[model samples]
Target: MQIAKVRGTVVSTQKDPSLRGTKLLLLQLLDEEGHTLPEYEVAADSVGAGVDEWVLISRSGHAACRVQGNEDRPLDAVVVAIIDTIYLEKRQIYNKREQYR
Candidate 1:
């Protein structure tokens, strides 16, 4: 999973049948500090994420296509979770001990 920020919403009047009713969002990839990455993408929102929310993105083809219980969506990326917070150790976010320390 990669961290991303919701930048905007996608409004598609016509799309693939598998994508019907799915919420597409414009995501700007984010660093640990929530800074927007240079590149951005549009992702399917199965978890009801909102703009400005820090989210966990699932970029796996299988996982993204598994939305609505169908493994055939045209989706190449999707939002899987809304991150409440992420703990980091040093420059890497590998430790949660600081939360207790």
Candidate 2:
């Protein structure tokens, strides 16, 4: 798993049949300090993560397919959780409540 930020939504009218109705999100990978990295990914949203939210991402296609309803879909990544807080070196770096407010 990896940490990333949901940067935006990805809309596709034409895609594999198994992918229909799945919410796709554009994610920017985050560094250990919570800063955005240059790498970007499009992931199936299994956790209903919204834009700007820090999320836990499963980057394995096999793991993504194991998520409920994502079975057999050609997914390379999936949003598995919406992060509520992040602490590093005893310092709080992110708090969802405070960040959204």
Candidate 3:
């Protein structure tokens, strides 16, 4: 799994039937240290993630497709969790709880 930031949403009027009712989100890849990378991907949202939220993503084809309960779907990435906090060693690096407080 990789850390990513939900940057935006993707809308499609015509898409594969297997993707119907699935939420597509634009994700900005992030390092373990909470730094943004130059890479980005459109991932299927399985955990109801929202923009500006830190999320856990599975990039494996099988894992990605499995999360949405559609193993045959053409998906490369999927949001698995909405991160509430991130800590490196003894130090806290990120806290989603603080954002809403």
lDDT (0 to 1) per candidate = 0.78, 0.91, 0.89
Per residue, candidate 3 scores C-alpha lDDT tens digits across 1-101 of 88999999999979998888888999999999999999998988878898899999888887876764757788988899999888899989999988778
Candidate 2 lands at a TM-score of 0.95
Q: Model 1, poorest ten-residue lDDT window?
A: 91-100
Q: Which candidate is the best by TM-score?
A: 2
lDDT agreement of model 1 with the native:
0.78
Assess candidate 1 and give its TM-score to the true structure: 0.80
**Which parts of model 1 are misplaced by more than 4 Å?**
90-101
Q: Of the candidates shown, which would achieve the greatest lDDT relative to the real structure?
A: 2
lDDT of 1 by residue, 1-101 (tens): 88988889889877888777778899999777666789788988878887777788988788887766547787789898877767675554522344236
Residue 41 lDDT in model 2? 92
User: What is the clash count of model 1?
Assistant: 0
TM-score of each: 0.80, 0.95, 0.91
User: Candidate 3 vs. truth: CA RMSD?
Assistant: 1.3
